[model samples]
Target chain A: MYLEIKDLTVLYDRAMVLNGVSLTVGKGEFVSLVGPNGAGKTTLLRAIAGLVKWEKDTLKGTRAGRITLEGSVKFDGEEVTNLPAHEIVRRGLILCPERGRPFREMTVLDNLRAGAFGCKDKKVVKENLERVYHLFPRLKERENQISGTLSGGERFMLTIGRAMMSQPKLFMIDEPSVGLAPKVKEDLFARVKEIYEQGSTILMTEQDVSFAFDLAGRNYVISKGHLVGEGTAEDLLADESLRKTYLGL
Target chain B: MVEAILINGLVLGGMYAILAVGFALVFGVAKILNMAHTAFYMVGAFLILIMTIMLGFPSLPSIVLAIAIMGITGSVIYKLFLDRVKEHPVAVMIISVGVAILFQEVLLIGFGGHFRGIDPFVRGFVEIAGIRATYQQVIAIATSLVALVAIRLLLSKTRVGNAIRAVAEDREIANVMGIDVSRMCVITMGISAVLATVAGAVVAPIFMVHPLMWMHPLTIVLAAVVLGGLGSIKGSILGAFILGFAETAVVFLVPMGAFLRGAVGLSVMVVVLLLRPEGLFGVVFEEERL
Candidate 1:
């Protein structure tokens, strides 16, 4: 396995967000986690990306409740559960957070440049910039525009493009299609497929079932912080309870 | 008389700009209302005094040494104290205020309560725009301009500068992008301290240095920062100059106006807040503020 998570659990002041959830993805594989709202899908991704630990460390005494995270996350055969988010990114595990947060005050170009912050080679950054531009021509066209002013779909595209600048080993995207028009969502879906076909390992959590089932090679169904079902789309869909209760299909 | 006011106001505004920019930078980047900021300014002046007058070091090296020490102090303070309580704004403010008072008391005990002064880095007067000003005032203005321009370039043109801005815009997202948010905050605090120390070092010759001097300037910086809208660097600079000119104008126009200068500056800030709550150049929405 290129990425393995075992017995992962997270708690916010005793409210269990994720409970003993485990999953895996092989190199160059595309995996999707499909679940309803508050199903711990996002939390699972955040734990893998080390953001849950970040919140736990930074917001220790504030109004935010105490967070307890447990489990092992091994990436590229190294345990990364204790690493900081930036350190995790240094190892090529990049998380494109939900909501298309494109560093709102920055220009489209600067946001992409920031995405390549860890890579010191100027030539590599330039090459990544060209690749991102090739992947999303809209970003190149609006390179000078402030990201906050971009349309919802454009913002999502910019978010994904920004992530591509980092040269990810395992790209984790959380809820990319949220709050997007169907046409814009379709464009993003196609772009994601192209990114996967270009030989990248991907793990995405999404609420849109059809969107997830169509693109991902393997799928996992999660509900109330537990892994309810896992298999290929056909095998999972064949189960009636998972389809009716978890998938809402 | 008008020329004197214009020249004096410009000089005062330049000093205030340097002072308020540091305060605003920390607030903008770390969301910290560091009450100890002006205290660090006072410490800078005292360090210069100790190095040049007491230890007999050259003026230039003393200034450089003072700034370096303050920068390290700023970074340490953030890492050790502020970083732990950053999430609670009220706690952060209280702790910073305690730090300021601690500095004041330490200075009072060490140097006594009397005012002291340092020799100006430069002497003599120069005529500019039909007005005569001391070389010290000229240095202050020149230093302010250079610092502001350098800071502008650093923020807009460099990779580290872009990362700082990104951290300021959204810290969590910046972290996910592989930028170390804590390191950025520490660097910002160091820069903020360096700016304040430079202001203190340059102005120590013109202004009397005392333990209590920080209080008045802290109030003025608070007024400037609030008037300009908190966390906007350009707004803080503009607010500082506006208040600087307002205070200078009051000193020239009002009867016994020298004592009323602080009041006039604060009243201007209040009026501006009443009219435009966000302050000039400040983000209007709460969520979008830098």
Candidate 2:
């Protein structure tokens, strides 16, 4: 019950992207939601982080009217389903969205500094920034480089490092390893583990079944906007039907 | 004669730069061309005209109040109207044009068709570069230069200012980083209005103020923004000076100078835009598309 979702449903116009989905992650738990494409994993994460709610509120009454979202998201026993994205981040829930999507115009250091913008204490902001640099020394080396100029591996580091600056209690990362080389993916996933050990709970979604199974203590299989299966990596792997059918493992 | 022309061109161009900076800033961050922006300029000029001429108030405090009133109006326009239709750029543009006409008609009803003007904010003359200019011209140059510098410092030094730039680059990304994109948009609109109102109030002493005053600045600034590359501050300032000199050079060097002012200024923009579609100082890769 540390981070809980219940009866969450999201509809874009007439198509349902998430259907009455519910899940939970205890404090310090490392969970992975693994599935193939079109499985509503990103939508579920976006819904929990308050971005989908914002889109619903913003787009309502427009010509492209009405995105219906019905859900309850509870973080640390507090309902955050209706909060704005900024407010949600303030409450220690950060969503490092898919793709690096770094502020392309800003330098690497500035982009990292922006991550800690919500913090009031200058000392804390500086400390968090230094921690991010320590975790990824490559970022320190390219601190002055414009983000748009960084290589794919570097952009991924900056994206994860930028999320770290927020000092989140629970980090939700979507497809952090996508498009990365196998070698770079190994390095990046190792850093993700280091981040978990540093005492931040994590909920990650991935298409790499072997990687997810190796990293997560618990796993959920989502396909076609429904939570089709859930269990420990061993338990799910033992079920041949769940492995071959929904997860493609 | 050449020195006089250059100084006057710089002075007038400085005003245009100040006026267009707001237009560029609003468009840069919010992507709303805000046709109503010049409406704030007109409103500020009239505010100064009324306080100084009819109420016999001191000009400095009147100018300050005029800027303050326009600042609030700018915020209201963004929040109440612009924010509502932001998803549709065409709708936002139309609403802004509507806002402009609404303010123009209000001024017409209140001030009548007769022109009004304000006394100089300061009285004196100084010689610079072998050219004698009034204190008003000096004030215009100094104010615009100082405002531009302050804008630079604000963008570089303050967190809110940096947040504004981040939002301008990509609002959704900025939002995910915990910056309030909506708040930044409204605040940017407010700052843009302040610049426009200050430009209008400061220039009222030199020129006649009327309901129709908004049209010329709107045209010149649109040319400036388009010439300098849209949504770029440096480009807008550079474009303003170039257009200012182009217009003035027409009057200075040509016999039928007065008749050719608008044509000459616009021609420079057209040719440059054809040659360099992105304007002189437009960022090479960044299109301000987002």
Candidate 3:
């Protein structure tokens, strides 16, 4: 496995957001974690990306509730469980957070440029910008427009495009289809598919079960802080309990 | 008389714009209500006095050294104190207030409460539109415009500036993009300190320097920042100029207006706040503030 996890448990004060959950993803594999709202899928991704640890460190002395995280996350055979979020990103693990949180006041192009902040070489950055523009031509057209004014689907594209600018080895996308119209969702699905086909590893969490199943090579079913099942789409669908109870299929 | 009012207003507004921009940047980037900000201005003025008068260093080098020292002091303050308490807003503000008072008292003990003066970098006066203005005033205007334009370029045209803006806008998202948020905050503090110090150094000859001089600027700067909408750089500059002109206009038009200047400026703030609670350029959404 390129990315390995073991016994990852996260506690926000007394609430067990993720309880002794473990998972893995091999290089260049497309894996999806499908679960309903509050099922700990987001928590799992956040823990892996080091954001939960960041929250814990930042909220240490404040009245903000405490977060206790315990686990081992190894990316590319290196321990990343204790690394800061920026360090995790520097090592090529990136998260496109939910709602496509564009830097609302900045231009679309500036947002993309910000995404490429870590890369120092101007040539490489320019190439990445062109590549992103090629992938989503709409971004190129609206490059000067403020990102806050972008529509739901365009924001999602911008988020993904921004993530692409980072040259990630593993992309963790959280709920890309949420709050988007079906047509927009279809367009995003095609973009994600193109990204994966171009040889990128992806671990995605989705509420839309069929959407996840349609694109992901493998799947994990999570419910209330635990991974209930894991298999290929056909294997999980054939399991009557997982499909009906967890997948809501 | 009109030229005198216009020149004085421009000079005062330019100084206020420089001061408020620094204050606004610290607040925007670090979310710190840094009460110690104008204290840096006081320190800068005094530093020039000590170096030029006591140590016998040249005036220009003294000013440059003072600005540099304040920049480092600002960075160290953020790293040593502000960074730890940043998650707690009230704690940050209280600590900053404590810092400001500490600077004032230390200066009072070392130099006494009597007002002091420093020689201007450029001596003599220039006639601008039939009004005689000191060369120091011209320098202040030029420096303010130059500093603001440079800062604008830095924020808009450079990679580090983009990262700074990114951190200011959304810290978590910036962290996820591999931009070090703490480092950005520290750098912003340093920049803010430099700006305040420059404002102090340039205007030291025009205004008498004293340990208590920091208090008046703090009151007016807070008003300007609030009136222009907090955390918006352009708004702060705009707000500063408005108050500067308003106070200058009062001084020209009303009897005892010099004494009534601060009250008039703050009244503008109050009226503006009553009409638009967010100020002229303030964003309604907390997340959108910069």
The collision pairs in model 3 are none
- Greater-TM-score candidate between 1 and 3: 3
For all the predictions, what are the DockQ values? 0.83, 0.66, 0.86
Query: Compared with the true structure, what per-residue lDDT tens digits does model 2 show for residues B34-112?
Result: 8888888988889888888899889888889988988888998899999877877898889999999999999889878
User: What is the lDDT, from 0 to 100, of the residue B189 in candidate 1?
Assistant: 93
Best-to-worst ranking by DockQ: 3, 1, 2
Error of 1 at A234 (Å): 1.1
Error of 1 at B173 (Å): 1.0
Tens digit per residue, CA lDDT, model 1, B1-290:
78778877877888789889999988988988999999999999999999998999999999999999999999999999998889899999999999989999999999999999999888899998778899998898888889899888998878888899999888888988899999999999999999989989878998889999888778789889988888899999998888888888889998899999768767877887899888888885445321
Q: Would you estimate the TM-scores of all the predictions?
A: 0.96, 0.94, 0.97
The model with the greater TM-score, 1 or 2, is: 1
Better of 1 and 3 by DockQ: 3
2 or 3: which has the higher lDDT?
3
Q: In model 1, what is the error at residue A9, expressed in angstroms?
A: 1.2
Among residues 3 or more apart in sequence or in different chains, the pairs in candidate 2 whose N, CA or C atoms overlap within 3 Å are: none
